[model samples]
Target: MTRHDPALSTPAQSALDALRANVAVPFERARAMPKAVYTSPEFAEAEARHIFAAEWLCAGRADALPNPGDYLTMQIAGEPVIILRDREGVLRGMSNVCRHRMSTLLEGRGNVRSIVCPYHAWTYNLDGSLRGAPAMARNEGFCKDDVTLPTVRVADWLGWIMVTLNPDAPNPADQLAGVERLVGHLPMRDYREVFREEFRWNTNWKVLAENFMESYHLPVCHAGTIGGASDLNQMECPEGEAAFNYHWIIKNDLVPLALAHPSNTVLQGDDRRITWLLAIYPALLVTLTPGYFWYLCLTPDGPGAVNVLFGGGMSADWCADPKADQHFAAVKALLDDVNVEDKGCVERVWKGLCAGMSGPGSLSHLERPNYDFARYIAGRMP
Candidate 1:
């Protein structure tokens, strides 16, 4: 699709060009992406089109909609999307816009017998087929059977609901196969989502994603909570793949939450003491610890803003413990504190980009994730 935003003028194009050039450099020689990439509306538009629109993005947990007709609606890649469990217990995704007048069909989350448009009441079945349309009998050529909500591709990968607007987008399950084996010890299917929150940050989406993918800033940015127990030197960042990137950090002490439950004998050696942070390219950020798992689904609002849905859960084994309630409260508090720290740091970074006083900075050996992330962005851009 062609983007005609005035923001795509000469200066924005120049900045994007520079960023693409910088990303092409070898990781050892590469500097950070140009500030414009985080401050330019044109570049953000490009990303929405090339990356978000074309990729399979994690929306939320499939378990959230356990029964048939349960549905959730959200905007993905700037388009409204509806995810629902059909009568056959199959998960489906479709455009939320009513085909008649283009009005949105649903809001938030709920169980609905049929998707009835608020404006004209153009009704659709749970499977997205046109069911009823008021006052259409007089229209000679109108055929309800010929109309249906446009289907968006949908997949459930390890219990997470993933959707894609691109008709030909690769299957998320195929791309994320490695993740299953990586965290197979955790009962991902049984880990119910116990908490969820949405936050809007005045920073580029990439800034938040890269921030979560690396451990280099933990000692300084998250000094009060997790940082206190972390040793940056102990981090192990493996080379990133085309679909995802990950790193592991060993905890100095056993996490209290993990200790409250029996250890999964399936975990070997230092795996019990390790925390893994993974980024599924484009926007999904996942953290897997022995005690719990959390994910942040990032969506770019524009060059200077992002919308985030953060959700997490305790492992099935941990949730079965007698002290699960107390432990959950503590874990939630820790997550809240970490969120505050990350917000402050990324907002400051956005301000730095706005100042326009400095160019891209060199990447630290510890920031390999950022290096790979930059290249991923560059590869998606024009």
Candidate 2:
């Protein structure tokens, strides 16, 4: 008789084994990821340490912080970090915790000349150097030059602001080179960020991420919003690389803003109608069309919740059009509806997983991106 060792069969360990099993087969024989991969707290903790803390995470669009002093703060696997443009107009990332007392320095997205700790009135320059402290004049051998917030790794890839706590993490540009080769003609770096919002959802981060990666759910779940527009047969999902997965669709002109602007002569033929769905490793999901782009940067709150930084805007061609304002208004309204539909679908999936009887089934051919995504997740597990 086979004996099960309790020490070797933890919830997290069992989930890891299931994930390995799921990704072991080729796409033709693959199945959906097991429920424990999304519902187990222990597994979530392991992911937090091995993936979120170790990978480069998208903070938001670098264009959103165009002006000096504009800054945004985020927490990656419980580490508070700040991304900002300093006085010299340099993009930087640094620890957001105060040097003296460890209080969180900044709250959210805003423009700040300097970071000031509310607990003790200790101030830091936009470059993260110490500017002042309220009562440290008489301290023994204390020099302001020696005091500064620790710098975190920050990179501007295309237009996205990427932050990482891992000092040895690979350059964002190098890692996403495949994505640039596929969408380089779209001028993604110049796309103006028109809107950004952060919200928490009552679902696992991977559940929402997998939902975005595959269009198979569009016809059913997003029927009220974008379902009728999505043709599964038109999507082209090639094999994914180590860093990202992308599938492109030749879109119809149902939404005018989804096609290239008349002035965008650079895009011709089918290129003008191509919409690329890019899933950057770990948690950046982007929907890039010729005229506009939108993205979601996900951070796990726990096994049952995800914190999202959602934003998007018009391409340079669209932004320069005479009817830019009117076009953006329509596109924004459509995005809001699409988001509503997605929220409903993914939340229900999470709820079903919680019922404890849910089991993964055979993956459809349309779910190729999901299979690649599952492989990415499984590869991240140590």
Candidate 3:
């Protein structure tokens, strides 16, 4: 089988071939991925087809839609999708486009009794079945029961709502069993989501994803907020698993809330201050700690833009504290500051990647997760 597709533009094929070559060597000798992989439109399109469309992507947490009518909308590889809970208390994924005339049915996140189209009054039940259509009685061929919205695949794995355009994709929970074994004692599903925000950054999605995969840049890029607390010599970057990659660093006293709460008996000794950074396959990036957790779900808007779903919250132990509100306020402030620093760093890298003289560089030992991520990407390319 050929690594490059014949239909791909010459530049895209060449870029993908370079990426494959970059990951062919052992991790200790691996170099950085070629610059073209982040700047090629054709290559991004190929990723949309083979990776985003074929794999399960995180859609925030299931707790976001607690009621039957609560729903949220997002685009998966350019296809608008709705994640909602039906009256039967079942979570579902469905087309967000109206069945009548293809107009979008919902916007952002909110609770609705039913999905009503603004264009022509087409209504749909929470389960995505066509409820009613105005002035359609005269159309002899129009059957309401036969005009329901199409269903998409959705699943709740460890409190995260995961969706996929491909029906043949493996179950996320089954594929991520390794992750469960690592963090299962923490009760990840019980963590409450305190805040969720949407953002668009001036950088490639892969750039941001790779940034989250490795902590090598934390000491420099996030110097103002989190850098001083992270010790490069203590960062752990083990070989990545098939479904995800992770690294851990012990928390310092910089932010007291980052450590385990006094009431958190689950994490003892050094585990109390350990912070885990996890990159779940294609797009979910998470930072899990003993007291709080935050995550980003990434999707590419184009070669130069990335759409992000950013959210975080405290663990049940911290939330039950008498000063829970104060603790969370401090955590949120720190996260916002860290994001500002990251935005500046990644965007600058993108600007450099666009330069004519820019190209691949050598990988650091701390970048083991990045090399694994490159291998995953190359494995999915045409």
Candidate 3: count of backbone clashes, pairs at least 3 residues apart or interchain: 0
lDDT (10s digit) by residue, model 2, range 1-382? 2223344338888898888888888899999999999999988988988899999999999988989999999999999999999988889999999989789989898999889999998999998899998788899888999999999999988889999999999898898898888899888998999999999999999999999888888888878877888688877778888998888878888888999998777889999998999999899999999999999999999999999999999998899999988998998999999999899989999999999678889988888889988998887777
Order of quality (lDDT): 3, 2, 1
lDDT of 3: 0.91
Write one digit per residue (lDDT tens) for candidate 3, span 279-363: 9999999999888899999999989999999999988888899998998999899999999999998999999999999877899
lDDT agreement of model 1 with the native = 0.84
Per-prediction TM-score to the true structure, in the order listed: 0.94, 0.96, 0.98
179, model 1: CA deviation in Å? 2.4
- Candidate number with the higher lDDT (2 or 3): 3
Ranking by TM-score: 3, 2, 1
lDDT of each: 0.84, 0.89, 0.91
Model 2: how far is 260 from its true place, Å?
Answer: 0.7
Q: What is the lDDT of residue 38 in candidate 1?
A: 83
lDDT of 1 by residue, 120-167 (tens): 999999989999999999999999999999998999888899998888
lDDT of 2: 0.89
**TM-score for predicted model 3 compared with the true structure:** 0.98
RMSD each, Å: 3.0, 2.5, 1.1
